[model samples]
Target: MRGVVYFIIVMLVASSLGCISEKIEKPDKKRIHGPKTKKIEEKRQVDSTRKRLGVVSGKWEQLNGMDGGDMHFIYSTRSGVLFVSHGFGGVWRSKNGGESWEIIKQEDFTDVYFYDMEEIGEVLYAGSNKGLWYSLDEGESWTKLKTGFPEIDDGTYHLVSLAKYKDELFFTAVLDKKYRNGRPGDGRLFVLKRDKTILELEAPANKEITVSAKYPYLFISSPYSGLFFSTDGKRWRKILDKKTTNVFVDGKYNLYVGTIGDWWYIGRKIGNTWKWEQVKIPGRKNTNSIFYFLVPDPINENRLWFGCGGVSRFYSFSARGFGNSFFGVGCWNGELKDWKIHSNYATSIAFYGDEKVKTSCGEATKYALVTVGRQAVQKTMDGGLNWSNSYEGVFGDTINAINPIKSGILSGTIVVTAVSGTEIAFNNGEEWMKGIDLRLGKEVGGGKLPGYPWCAVSPERRIEGKYDLLISTGYPSPFRGDGVFGIDTSCLVRGGRNCVKKLIGGPHYEMVISEGKLYAGNMDNGIDVLDLETMEVSKIDFGSGVPLIRKFDGKLFFETYEGKYLGDGWRWSGKKGKIYFYDGRVTKTIYEEYAINFSVNNREFIALTPESLVYKPDFLSEEEIRVKLPNKKYTDMAIAWEKGIIFLSTDGEGVFYTTIDELKSGGVRLKEFNNGLLTLKIRNLVYEDGYLFAGTRGYSVWRVKPSQV
Candidate 1:
């Protein structure tokens, strides 16, 4: 029965196959096709793609590194060679002024100590923890001259000053004598001669001579004995014998002494009689004060400079003119002049001023606005000509978004989705209104969104008929997302009391308002176009690919993973995907979409990811193409258009600026700040008035003004 069934099934299948074959023998007349042109068209497309790739050739110039450390002193020799000694280990030498530098010598023992350097003939002498080391051949080799000095049991020695008096070398060494409890200092002073003979001075017990100087006669100051004078280097005489901390000898042989009790005295030698007069140091009575060093003007002997507050204060003096005092890390013209504050907490000060005027800037200005990481905002007015703190109120610290409404009006806002709240401030950052509950549950379809908000606006949006502001937010989550908030003068004029309306798009998106139409590049969704008047939304798909859109030359440019295209209002169904061409020819393969920013002049556009800048001449006759950038990765850039300057904020370093001519001339000139650097993860660059504002991650907002830079 099984064999009969199998035979019957096989016979039925053969009959069906024969019937289908008979039908296949006669094709339908309507199904007939034409001659092939696909091969010819395919060859043309390949050649076109290759031509596009050949146009853009070179890469961008990489940014130079900005090393960090407190440079305590910078000195230049008579030959115009510059040297900088860090408060830490290294000593840097600059052959060509300070345009470039190289480390010459550094040792572990010299770390974290102030070095007193003096040049005698061609030899350079340095005093550090390891006693006195002399380099006779300009730092080529070193010899330790610690013999004949008091033994430093704990291997600690501090040399405060070195000077040459009457053709004899004099140096002051503080030896740390061991005690039963292992504490330093039984208070000993030593005088070293030019011939390396060390004579120990008999310092009073329980007192230490903090500093010593020579003007042929050795003068040392003690906390217990006012002043001690040694004319022959061994036997010391207690002259004034009042407790003094610092002593200096003037050109007229007048001795100036500063005491620990906040008083100064001057003693003049007249034949056989010495007269002592007490002087007052104004505005320094109640402060922790100590006079450290003094410098007389090279061109003027009557002019004297004093360093006080242990290396912080500076005072200038003259024979009859008003003295100038600098209370902080700044300079002074004369000792009687009023104190001027240059910076809030200046780490270092340098002079590039002329004789008639002395100008000093601080290192703190570097991280002014853009130093804050996430939730940082910076704003300035007067086209970056001047700037003020605008993030004080909003974040109660610094913020990431600094949206400026006008010259005197600014807002600092921060969005943290995890906290379920956002912060907003108006009135130029004097105060902030925070905890604006984003009713996400009632306002939109929400469970728990993955990212925070990033805000941006179109160039056409106006604020107060003067400046323009676009507020944006970005997701702090793993997935990069953005949200944009639109504000007008009416909202800002009301001090942000009015609820500013939100434009369309979600966490990871960008909203660009062009020609009165709002265009959004969505991460999950395709590009969405919304009519400003009717509030109608239209979505254009790049066929399973995400599209990033930018508006240029009065048209919308869309880029996606597949290709590039120019969208016509509603649909991207245009001419297959035309590549950017020069002389009416196709260019290279369109890479994956990322980010872009305009140069200061707006004549050039910089595209991110495999970072590159596209230059298009103002006239159409000139060729247009993309040029690759240096190897360092950059996420965003800000331009000071008037200055022809560009600032790139990096991840590991800080903000750097260069000129547009340098970028075009194949030279990359970058100026990196040592201070005021927030996290390297900068997201946005915006300039308003005279200041350049930057937004960073974790570090919130930072700003730098032209005057400050």
Candidate 2:
């Protein structure tokens, strides 16, 4: 057990004693888990058996980028800062004019969506679900405008348009669900006066007012009142009796009024008689209905760019949400791609495309392995550019785990776990041999054999000065690992009942090593540690459920599982699994949620969560740091500090990454590194040689190079 091998096989059955050797790594601090005075003393060194993978370096390949997320309001400031509201996510601003964008406020617009945003002078006015909000400091902060738009019966109000008239800012608070039934009265057209007082404009609510400096008259399109034109902002004239959807007046006094059912009425003045001609919209055929947009084209005079929204469909399990009405993004540029005709909403079109970050490709390692989820295990010698899976299509079930040991008696050997149990690859991945059945570790007839061939690892150990593989049952498997079955490369099973006793009553999946002893913590059983040299199983309990345990520097730190459930709130489970810390029988309540799959490196305790990567320097007195992820459901993350990069494995959206230092200090950017990922559900991630590896749930394992920074 006094070894730097990555093998963590925890078996706690009584056995004869052997000589005990130690590779003691000293600690500066230890957490006293005793009652009353429970506390973690100081920091300590990291002497982990398995070293971390990946490097801190280089440029990455190409990705479509910014392809996901729902689109909301799009605005361009006077300084040419283009911003798009990415649905549930906050505002994404493009500094160099939409060449790229970074999320400025990722948590904004969670409760509501933005309706409209326009820059007036220096302040940026935005109409949202909660009335009009003006941002004086560019988009950093926002304050609600008290322009007669008080909160209705519902908490939020629907603000549709914000316009400036006669040196005053006017906002039209339109019909919401509370007011749509004509109960909360009419929509309010309020204006912000010069003295900062909000005064109600003498105009009908629920009507969109179209203003143009080139035209003498202002047109208002109302659902009930049709089209009304005002000459002096007070005098009104009924221009058209037809229900107007959108009224647009260009610079040359040409009016293009759109109605329901894809009708566009173009009106222009010739001397005195104004001829209004109706025409069908072109280039938008085979698309869904059009919603909010009309940008006058500077390049093409006769045509206008429109936002032809997504297709509408009924909700059902078979539909899979692809038939949404707000999905399609349309353009009248005389060209259409196959994807444009599909049910995808494309907003905020920009040709200024540039990569947000550049990475430099570094040298690759000679040996690399690839394990697909239900497929073959391939290996490459020329740095992953080429792979060979000679024994493919042999296993009917999916391959789960791949553990390659380099310098042991089973050197150049790999251990694989799948639905049918463990398999071994003798020469890197050329040939694989089926090993023991997966049910060997489980109780004889307990609840049928678990299908998923979960944890499998072969730790390198020297028994009686003879180097042999003495590890099994990787830490915290799909379930309780049942027991450890030590086997050699040639299907030679080493440990039996004498090897590991039958574990019952509780799950024994999560395993760790400390003080020359292998410790296992399960959901039910309190705790059990195995002294490898003497080879004896000893159970330790604190009277409660030990859900999580980590062994560091001869001390045991554990948390009692309480009310952690899978389906709580909008989360599967949080990394905050520990409420109390324990060492031996000593216990102390830290009152912090630091980790679920916790790992400590250089005193940095990394807490991997579905939402964010929580980081702290130590158990106590360390400044807490959190790196927010763009998407939820983060499966795995790998930090390559030497090359200065950290890779994040997103569930369906592929991988994203950022620098190590930037992540620790609330990042400014985290680029998606999905160059070759086919599947969305990425389960595992690792960094080897110069490639960032992603183990997807479907398709196959993907590898990409992290360009050198």
Task: Give the top-scoring candidate (lDDT).
Answer: 2
TM-score of each predicted structure versus truth: 0.36, 0.41
Tens-digit per-residue lDDT, 1-709, candidate 2 = 0000121111221101111112335444343321232333322221233233233343322121102223445665666565554232234455554434444432233233455676657888877655677788777666766654456213345665565555566665555554445343245566567678877667632443323222365566554455566655566666666544455566666666644334445567564334666544434442234333343333333434333343111000111123122222122323322212222332322222222211112232333222221112223344323444311212122223333332234544433343334444343233433332223434531432232323332334643333244333332334444443344333334323322233223344334444556556544556766665776778876564454554333334565554443421211244435544454445665435534344444445555555566655555433566655555676666665556566776555666766656545544255666543334455555454445544443222334556653
What is the number of backbone collisions in each predicted candidate, taken in the order shown? 70, 34
Per residue, candidate 1 scores C-alpha lDDT tens digits across 649-674 of 65545566655555544335355632
The true-versus-predicted C-alpha distance at residue 654 of model 1, in Å, is 26
Best by TM-score: 2
Error of 1 at 608 (Å): 40
lDDT for 597 in candidate 2 is: 45
Task: Estimate every model's Cα lDDT from 0 to 1.
Answer: 0.39, 0.43
